[model samples]
Target: MTTNTTPPIPMDALRTLPTPELGMLLLERLGKETRFLPQNITAEARIAFKGESDEADLLDRVCEAWAWVESKALVSQVGTKTSDFRRVTTDGRKLVADPSALVRLAAADRLAGPMHPALEGHVRTNFHLGQYEIACFAAMKEVEVAVRDTAGLGHSEIGVNLMRTAFKPHNNGAGGGPLADAGAEGGEQVAMAALFAGAIGVFKNPTSHRTVTFDDPMEAAEVIQLADLLLRLVEKAKVREIKTENE
Candidate 1:
């Protein structure tokens, strides 16, 4: 008997692609082998595993999913690499030889279930966004922490005493004028200016109003910007996945 065994790969599970990428892998590897069509795999059965299932059976399903992936052209292998002189093997003229197409093919192979492509793409984009959010949060907290650690030091860079003071809107009668008069900047900036001015005026009168009434981190412009980027990336990937599914 010849020493040949095509290691079973999840070549069929990737049925969402056209004949070029995902399907191409399965077409090349399991060309002659009989395979099951995706139509035959019941949706309820596939979903049932998502709920209640034994661990071993889940693994079997994963393997079955892989086998299906192989069939669907999701994932493919490089074939055996035996170094023996007579045992050597090579692809025949029947297979597609183009190298560039394999990248999408390889991507299709690695993903699972619906939105696989989009999910994978989102994973990349979201990962970077997540890292950026973490960095910003760190920077914001560092200032607060710095103010606490340097209790006595008079450092202008990190405002410890300024943070301790109260800043609130002013509704009292004053020559300075109302909050939304002829010249108004922003609600927050206006609130800040009023609050500081009021604090100075009410310095001797401590029973006037509450101090520092601003929403914590109310202006997450940077975080919001990052979130917007991630949302668009996910939405775009989702649309692509939807298209791929129908294909």
Candidate 2:
């Protein structure tokens, strides 16, 4: 006589769950194995979900859910003689230890989808990992770099001064910076400078000097979005500068 083994979680129930939920379940399974081959995990998942749905379709869903886990950096492909093996990362272990973080991460990703390409790297990664202050700082720092590059300023000019010098208006026989909008009213130009300076001062500078608390993820996401807006403004300024030079 053969005895059947029961799946820890019913495969039928798992099928109805969302990507993050499915990903979490897969992540927990990965944690149990410690190290595994992607194909092997998917094959096992297929067996567990055997009668629940079409075999190919079930395999595709499991692979996609596992892919989500990889995308989020939960599991890393081990670098050994072969590339077929993967191990759960430290972050993945933490998530398995406290699944609440994965829920928070999913919510944050939904709120901050398709972030500016400039911010999609470090800023998004840190934000998803619950490092809110670091994410905010990195976003604002990208804004600072955009301003500096657009204005042709060297590395020595930085922080609020970089923003001021970059956006300083034409006034009192003084010429404006390359990024400054000469066509705009003098007051508007000055306000533009103030905008960049204030953003750097409030969001970026504090993180550099000391530890700043950002307990609320929603507020942190908004701050990163603000940085995205500032980067767009800098891009516009670059185009304006080029147009001014051409004319």
Candidate 3:
């Protein structure tokens, strides 16, 4: 008789694993089996996870992980019938062959949400290429260009100074900068200037003078999203300038 010698995976560890990780675990198992029913997979996971207590919870998590794999198109039904049997997809096999692909997949998933039209290509390409710092730099560069173009400032006016000058509040009966909201209170306008100036000073300036590092892709995505918001603000400022000119 053949001996079954596979070691049981600890349930404690499986409980804490992220959905994607759990999905990958299931995918790995499916890759070995070639085809499997969802319930059988869940049973197998329960046994492999050593889930004697809270079996229902373990089964639910396994099912959820399986669903995530299916949602990602990593697995496909084996036939035309409404059957639970599924086989790993070509992409799934590729992912299994190269574990690093999971990192790229996660990065792509993080950036899958809606972004500013300006950043959709530039930031994402750099981010996907693992150029996190360059991704952030490219995003903030867009903000700087939008600010300069909206305020009609020359390229010589750059960085924090450019942001301050472009968004400077009205004072002493003098008109505010082109991007500044003239109708707003001086304090509010000053706050806007400080907001833009601070963002440029912190996020944009260092990337220009030195090599900045961004090890965390999620953090880099947040920086890009911030740039997206600034771009929208610049567009609003441009619209306000046009309206003011018409008036």
Q: Give the alpha carbon lDDT tens digit for every residue of 155-220 in model 1.
A: 452332333322222234332222122123447535544443333233312212333221212222
Q: For model 3, how does the per-residue alpha-carbon lDDT over 1-247 read when each residue is reduced to its tens digit?
A: 2124242223564679987888887787678876777667655665654535666676677777878888888988887657767888888998888777787677667678888888988788889788988989999999999999999999999999999999989996797788999888899999999988988898889999999888776678778888988999999999999998899
Among the numbered candidates, top TM-score falls to 3
Each candidate structure's TM-score, on Cα atoms with residue i matched to residue i, is 0.17, 0.58, 0.76
Quantify all predictions' global Cα lDDT against the true fold.
Answer: 0.34, 0.82, 0.81
The model with the greater lDDT, 1 or 2, is 2
Over 211-247, each residue of candidate 2 has an lDDT whose tens digit, in order, gives: 9999877788888989988999999998888887899
Candidate 2's TM-score reads 0.58
Answer with 1 or 3, whichever has the higher TM-score: 3
| lDDT ranking, high to low | 2, 3, 1
Model 2: C-alpha RMSD to truth? 6.3
Off by over 4 Å in 1: 1-133, 139-247
lDDT of 2: 0.82
**Model 3 segments more than 4 A misplaced:** 1-9, 14-21, 27-40, 46-53, 72-108
